[model samples]
Target chain A: MSIIIRGARLIDPGQQLDQVTDLHIKNGNIEAIGDLTGLNAASEINAKGMILSPSFVDILTYLRDLNQIQKGTIVSETQAAASAGFTQLCASPDTQPCSDAGSVISMVNNKVVSAGFCDLLPVAALTKELKGTQLSNMEALARAGCIGFSNASYDISDNNILLRCYEYAATFGLKVFVQAQDQQLGDGHMHAGATATRMGLDGIPVIAETLAISRHLLLMQHTGVSGHFNQLTSAKGVNLIRQAKAQGMNITADVGVAHLCFTDTAIDGYRSQYHVQPPLREETDRKALLAGIKDGTIDAICSAHQPHESAAKCAPFAATATGMAIYDMLIPLIQGLVDAGDLTWALAIQALSYNSAAIAVGKTPKLSVGEEANLTLIDTSHYWTLNSSSQLSHGTNQALANQNLKARVKLTVKRGLVSYQM
Target chain B: MHNLAELQLTKNGELRHFLTPEGLDRLMLERILDTADSFVVVGNQEVKKVPLLRGRTVVNLFFENSTRTRSTFELAAKRLSADVLTLDIKTSATSKGESLLDTLQNLRAMHSDMFVVRHGDSGAAHFIAEQVTPDVAIINAGDGRHAHPTQAMLDMLTIRRHKGKFEPLSVAIVGDILHSRVARDQIHALKTLGCTDIRLVGPNTLMPQGIDSMGATTHNNMESGIDGADVVIMLRLQTERMASAFLPSAGEYFRLYGLTTERLAQAKPDAIVMHPGPINRGIEIESAVADGPQSMILNQVGYGIALRMAVMSMAMSGQMQQRQAQALVSSSLKGEAQP
Candidate 1:
């Protein structure tokens, strides 16, 4: 298959390239770039006045496939990922019949391969059944096509066992994704503050993240493990990770887009859509997370796309399942970050594309010669409302529903295939 | 209108569900007090019954056990001539593991026109009000540390009947305001009724954070808080508060902050004392102060019935009006279809 995208503003953050140019693809690879006016192809996309960049890489997502297919499936949700301009989505291992063993990893990998919409890189559970009792067969899971190992927000009560798990993961060269949280202290459904107190809901304090992050950082230094802290929601957590990096610790961290956009005050009306794990914190924490993103202390910003059916979020705010369906709003939210001046387009692309891909896949998908054509064309200045009617995910719990977004995905191409088009 | 207060009203701002006092205005609150005033005369009469809610069915859905509050609400509904169904929900289908929604649905199927709810969870009453069948009135009896509007209104009535208007009153709410929904509702009601010099008297651990932001001055010392206050409201310290380590012991709490004769002397000479009853005597108040000449504590219980009668009748009236409006709209649509 051969195709050409013409007159698009190409941005390759990994290569530090941002310019309007024409690119040609053939046989699932970038054939040529610059002045492709004379080129003729079977399929030509008039990408005039569009920002064509490498497709995004989401470091955390819960497709909720397998036995928990009632929430979402690989087929339905991966397409939602495609529509969101994400060509590579690293799914969390928190599914039913979790991706702990090689068989489950293989099942997820095979399903992703068959779906063929986008790459669904499986993150195997760091512990067996994510119960934190014993370590899973990490070697076999890696061999079965798991990209990384994560406990997916499950707390390992035994720190000694957790350190051993880290040591073993380091030996196997598996990047460990730790969602730092003290489950015991994090009993509440929302951020601990005057807001939670006034709302009469239980509260999760900032120490829940900072204390856990501090412990993990210390363990990372001791065990010599490559730890990537997923969903750091507190300012203190960011400061701790920053300090760890300054001290030459092999660690990285990412914050969720919802954390970047909303705060605990968003749940003032008991709006359950904003009820996410590692709950949206206060304004100081939010400002710090954005500052971390801007200064490169935070390695990347991910969607942390947790999709849930309407019923899952229909209860009271505290009782409702935590997560927002953010797969189809990833690019738009990144654009919001850019428009707010907290991040430049370069930094946004680096976090959403290059940095995330590097942590998950060990390589960034850059648009260059002899590279696979995984690209997204976006209308970066368009405005649209993100209501239920406009959403493509099977999940209906959206924190930004009825919000006006200033950017949208126009087309997403994966391996030279037109995976999505608007 | 705050959350619960806003939820208690209809689109036209009429009282639909009297769930919280935080949203009711001075006029609406005065109307409730006035309505309760008329009921006081009825209570004093030979037959304490009215035909205001003659054929209406009022269901008391108490998820938590409450004998005193339940009886008063039952009496109020009975006085309004509404057929009352008092369900001991803790041991009913809810105890059998039926969800509150499912139980309410089953009860709604019984054709009850109103629900007077008392639950252990904050916002449980609001949840019921939001989920119940349309045109069904919901009166929050007492929810967990959130709001007990009827109790707050009765306190408002008790204060008004004793001391007159709230505009010039300096009220001090003492005790575990952190765990007392009555205190929360009273604070909002006091503020709405133009009571500006409101003071919350409790230790820092016993006070809810940001209570000062609600326009109430907070004080740790009891004497300073009650000094020059015209009304002193004592809140019952929940035993759970002690277990939660908010206080060391009931005895220790009584030693520091308990209302006694000496402490009551710190307030104005004309100041009256109030408590939503079933008080923990010696823990929250001394027996002498509770039984003193200025003690309107028992009067609060009497006003509680009148206040409940006011809320039940008002919510039923709002629901009836809403139903009539809906019927008119549907009939108008049918007429249009005929044309």
Candidate 2:
């Protein structure tokens, strides 16, 4: 199928291109760019008031299914992702039955193919069963179609096991995604600060992330492997990653959209939905995360889209499951950062698409001739409310369930096919 | 704060539930203390039963073990002539795959009009209070380090009887404020009652952060905190504090922050020493200080029943009034106005 997006403001930060142009797509590839005044096409989108950018790539997302279908499923969540304008989402390995084997990776790949909404990249576990003990068959799993290797916050407690896993990953050329959290220091359900104290819930101090990040950064340096920090949630963590990147270490980091939006104060009411892993830090941390993204200290902005069933999140704050359905609200949240002027549209595009794609696939789609037509059409001026009724994911645990925001994904074209339209 | 105080009140600020000491003003605190004043005499009566909650069923839903707190609540309910059912929740249907809501619904069906909840989670009482039907009253016995309103109120009753007024009092609360729901509730209660010079004395690790923001001054040293204070509250140190990195040993804690004869002497000569008992003698308090002449610990226990009775009667009255109002609203909506 051939498609043409007319008069859209194209922002491809990777190629340093930002201009109002028409994009012509044919056979799932970018056939042409610039003026095609008299060109005929199978379908035409009058995207005059839209911002066309390279489709978003989310580095950390939970596509919970298999035994954990109560949380979410591939068909439900990927559809949610499509509407959120995400073209590629790397699913975390923290699902039930832990995605550590080639069989599980192939099962997810098959599901993604059948769902056919957005591209779902499976991340295999670093250790066997993610038990922090023996290593998994990384070479086999990587070849079985895993985008990367990650334990997904499962503590590799044995230092020697972690080093061995990284060393093995480095040799196999598999990207290792590290969730920096010291399990011992992360004793509490929410951030360790005034809010946790006032709520009388135990706290996970900022040291949980920073201390673990420092330890992992040392191991990453020692092992000389490509490491990506996933869902970092602290000011000190931002500074640590910044120093590492400045020191020219092969370390990249991504902050969750929730971390950029909310602080520990959001849990003041003991709202369980606000309870999250590496729980939301203070306002200073939120500011630092935004600043990190703006100054290129953080490489990407991930949805950190953890979907949980309603019953799973309806308990007391400390006892409830820690995560939220964020895929459907990802773009609007990033747009909030852009509208606040804390992040330029170019930087937002770079973090959402270019940087994330580089970490996930080593390549990103572009708005040039011969490039694939994986793109997101966004209406920055459009206002939408994230109400319960509008949700598509099986999990209804949205922390921002009724939040009103600007910016809506008008269309999501994945490989020249109109995957989602609103 | 926990918003439990707000949840406990009716739209017009009547006490519909008694969950936490926060959000209560000096007037409200005084009202509770005043009501408790009359009930204190009732506890001294040969026939202790009152008909205030007659024919009403009060269920003590203790999800966490506390025989002492439960007995006080049970005595208070019995004294108010309410039929009480004490359910040890750990052995109840909650362990038989029954969800909390299901158990609550079953209890409600059994005509349990009031629930006294004690649980291990911080907001467990609030969660139960929120789940109950409109006419059902809920009182928080204690919820994980969050609040113990009745205990705080009883301490207030003890304080007012001894010190006469809160404004002229300088109270020092000693020991582990971090893990004690009693301390948090007392802090809120004291602040609400206009007790300005509230001092929290403990090690930094044993103190809840930002607690001083609730209008109390924090002191790391025990002597400076207790000096010239009119009331001294020595909190019992839990053994778990030692297991955590909060304290080195029970002996070390006693040496640094324990209420001994010498340390008690730092307070005013007439200053009363109080402990929310099951006192850890030699850990949080010395036997001499705990059994000392200035010790109002026994008086605090005596007032506990009266304070709890006052809370139950007040909350039940509020619920009854609200239920009547709801009935009138529904009747009027049906065009059956009495007027």
- Give candidate 1 misplaced runs (Cα > 4 Å): A340-342, A381-389, A400-406, B1-6, B91-98
TM-score of chain A of each: 0.96, 0.97
Clashes of each: 0, 0
| lDDT minimum window of 10 residues, candidate 1 chain B | B90-99
List chain B TM-scores, each candidate: 0.95, 0.94
lDDT of 2 by residue, A1-422 (tens): 98888999999997899999898989989999998789989889888978999888888888988998888889999999999888788998877778888878788878988999988778889988889898988898877778789998887778999999889988977889999999888888888777777668888888888889999999989988899999989889999999999899998899888998888888876787788887998889999998898788899988888888777766555567788789877778878877777777888889889999998999866778898889899998888788877777777888777888788898998988888898
Q: Pick the candidate with the highest DockQ.
A: 2
State the DockQ of every prediction: 0.34, 0.46
Error of 2 at B49 (Å): 2.2
> What's the DockQ of model 2?
0.46
Instruction: State each model's C-alpha RMSD to the native.
Output: 2.6, 2.3
Quality of model 1 by C-alpha lDDT = 0.85
Report the C-alpha displacement of residue B22, candidate 2, in angstroms. Answer: 1.7
- Model 1 residue A71 CA deviation (Å) reads 1.3
Error of 2 at B27 (Å): 2.5
